[model samples]
Target: MNFRIPIFSLLMIGFSQSAFAQIKEEQLILDRKREPEIKKIEKKKTSVEAEKNYPPREKKIEDSLNLRYTVTDVPAASDFKTSTIQGEDISPKFEAENLNNYFQLGMGNFGRILADGNIGTKLENEIEVGADFHVLSTSGLKKEYPWSSKQNIGNVAAYLNANGEKGKFNVIADYGLNDYNLYGIYALQPDADTDLKQRTNRFKVNGYYDFYSNEILNNVRLKTSFLGDHFNAKESQAEIRVNLSKHGVELPVGNDVVLNADLGLNLETLNTDFAILQENSSKFLNATVAPQVTFFNGDSYLMLGSDFSFLNAKNSTANTDQVQENRTYWFPKAELQFAAADEFKFYAGVTGGLQLNSFANLLETNPYLLSDQQLRPTETKYKGYVGLRGDIDQQIKYDFRAGFGKINDMVFFRANDLFDTSVSGNRAAYDYANSFSAVYDNGKVSEVKASVQYFPLANLTLDAEAQFTKYDLENYEHIYNVPLLKAGIGAKYSMLNKKLHLGANAIFSTDLTTNSFEITESGSQPNVFISTENNDDKVGGYADLNLSAEYRVHKNFSIFALGNNLLNSNYQTFKGYKVLGAQILGGVKISF
Candidate 1:
């Protein structure tokens, strides 16, 4: 504003205005150059902070963009070769073996010799055929006794068996021959010569057939046998049976039921040529039908049945007229079983039947039986029994039973009269002092039996059994020659991987009462009365011990030795007959 605007002011003002304009222009250029760098730095800083909060977004794929894809062809399977893989050799360590035939031979004291053989073969049609033979012979102990007691027994059997899809069939034929001397008489004048040679022959044939179908009939069996002796005694028997059974009949109680039926025919005939016997020929015929039904639940079972029998018998005798008997009998049977637990069970039953006692049967039980004795059939009216049988543990099993029954015509053995004044020179009717006669009595019997088996180890077993019976005779004061108590104990042990076996057994029996006579002088006449002072009417009790050992020399061969009556106890199974003492036998067995 000075009138005189100085040259300096003008110049300063102009300089200031120009300098401001230049500064503004320079700032614009610098900002323009660094704008991209500054924006990048800010964008990075924003991205880092966004990433911390959320994941970064994926890039968008647009359809408009052009892309390329490549396809490659698969290789053909035929281009490669296949191969089979091989495995290591694996063979069985044990051999394949079978045992179907065997042979045994033995010798012992008392001049005993034994021989046995078996041979078997299988045919191409799957049928099996076999044959067996056995012989046992013993020389007499005449050095100790006055008579020779020699014996020889031989047996032969042949069998054929066939198994098919439908059933199994078997046929067997057997024959037995026995030669023995009756050496039981010792008091007949000491030098009385008697023809005591005896010979017996037995022949049998049996057939069995079973069906595997679901039909009512299942099996059929047939048996026929003939027995003859040199004493003009002959016996023959024949039997045939058919069985029908069906199972798994459902009941309303959600249980199953089973039914069984059996029909059989039996025929027997016996003829004896004893001069003094009244009856010489006896014949018997029986037809029986038995039907049974069983009902089973989870742990209990009931069995009910009945046996209907029709029996006929005819006897022809010299002293008595010919007699014929006919009878019909019905035997009812019922049994109940319940398992209290897995290892325990209780059972009870009632049973009855008619048993045929032929001369052959009587003689089989007692070979010393007198030939002229009367033979009759036995009738068991009824038998009731209760039993507890089960395993106490895995290794022990026990069974106990008690029964009572009545028997008609029960057979018993009695010693023949030793002294008969009627007969001259101590020669009685029986002629043999050690022989026995069969007697029949109607009696009631009560019996108790118990048995125990223990298998503490796989290779060791022990067993014991005891039986006691009491008889109330209807006609006799006592049951003659019937042991009141009988007991047996046995044990078997195996060692060395079953290569060695040891066995021991003991048998004991109580004393028995029998009738015996003594010779006494009465007014120069010999008198016979029952002995009372010499214990001759009583057979003393005895215990017998038997021991056996077997050692396997090879898989197919074994050696065995047996010692009988090892305790050397003087025992008599039959009165007046002493058993052998301390006898040993050794043998070898070979199997194929």
Candidate 2:
């Protein structure tokens, strides 16, 4: 069905290009009016001082003016979902489906504007609305179901920010909203069951105030903001900041030192009364107070910072159930830099936090006779990382980062322990890599390039990384190792007097980790089956290949085309999650 729609869309575009041209023209006008700041910035600046005097501002103005609209109606092929074991689940065969393979019929428009150097001057305003609708189907299912739930989701977002200088103070306010047709903090799985149908609404506001002073002994900045969302439920958070920094200051323990200090307070509340027919609704309220101090030397100097946060949470259910959870976290981050060469620089940093989550009568019995307290760990996760960076005249640059950490009271879900949660050994992950690029910036032509780095380690896991996720299910924790070496290389080149450009990228990884299941425990009843999946740290590796091209038809118009999975590779980024197979997409744009 997806493939058929794309074919139909092509025929329609050829038939009605002229009719829609006028609509595009009106949209361009509205685009400029909506983005005043963008027009101001692009008005041509003559001096560096003028640009520097411009107060710090969001980049939305610049980004909004260069918007692109895409309309594709094609059912591209999808990659098959790999099983826990390397063996294909032939009994319940899951066929490959296209990524963005479903048909799309929607209208989207975006715009932005900017302002020049001015204090107390409004900087930017932006608005955007985009939508997509598609029909997805599943042919094979392991379990019997009356029907496959329809998949439909739409999102809309807009932002506004204002900046100005009031007397000796710098002030700014920002507001925005993002609505998604999904729930939870975790990334949405394409096949995951979701009762959430409509888009979720979220609203946020942030503001900062800086009291400016040339006095070398005393300067201060104060900030406070609030964020909240209301749709299926209500969740709100607020924060405050007070900071002071001095230059060329002498302290009791040091000379020629820059001293800085900060104090903050935050409160977050989440209240939800899950509908019995839908899911369990729970309400929670949390508050915290944080304070910290940071110091940075003049240029090329050492940096140190530390802060502490305390939190309390009270949860209530529609059934008049209540629980309390408390936690305190200490976070400290530090960095150092060393010049290794006139053309090379090296820097390293380490950051992590000490966090403890405890339940004081935090759990109670539910109607299902399950102990909620057992589902959570008393001593949770405290993760950290250390990384280094090197730059060699931009032509050769690399970033290497390694992490050491785990959750003490990690949660993992199991079918057997549906109601009971067990504490798993800390699951740890460590990944480090470095990339090199052959880059050049010269008059008339310029191109930025980079190549992937190959590095490997143990004790790592891969999951949905596109967005945050949250759930009330048993904590399903697994220890997976990615000792595979991987590399990706890509570059862009411009021709036709820099009017047209082309780019391509390819990534590959070898040394596979295949899964193997074993009987961890048998059911209490004789002849009852019980088993778990084990993995082989060795097997066939996976690879991904992509290529794309762009052509500048004119100053106000351009075209782009691309193909992914050019080799039609079949693989998965993580177990159970399906990847997209070979696909192609192309579009055109017109801008003022």
Q: lDDT (CA) for every model shown? A: 0.59, 0.30
Q: What is candidate 1's TM-score against the reference?
A: 0.77
Pick by TM-score: which candidate is best? 1
Q: How much lDDT does candidate 1 score? A: 0.59
Best by lDDT: 1
lDDT of 2: 0.30
lDDT tens readout by residue for model 2, 22-73: 3222110001111112222222221012222432221222122112110111
Distance from true position, residue 231, model 1, in Å? 0.9
Q: In model 1, where is the ten-residue run with the lowest total lDDT? A: 83-92
Residue 418, model 2, lDDT? 12
lDDT of 1 at 291: 81
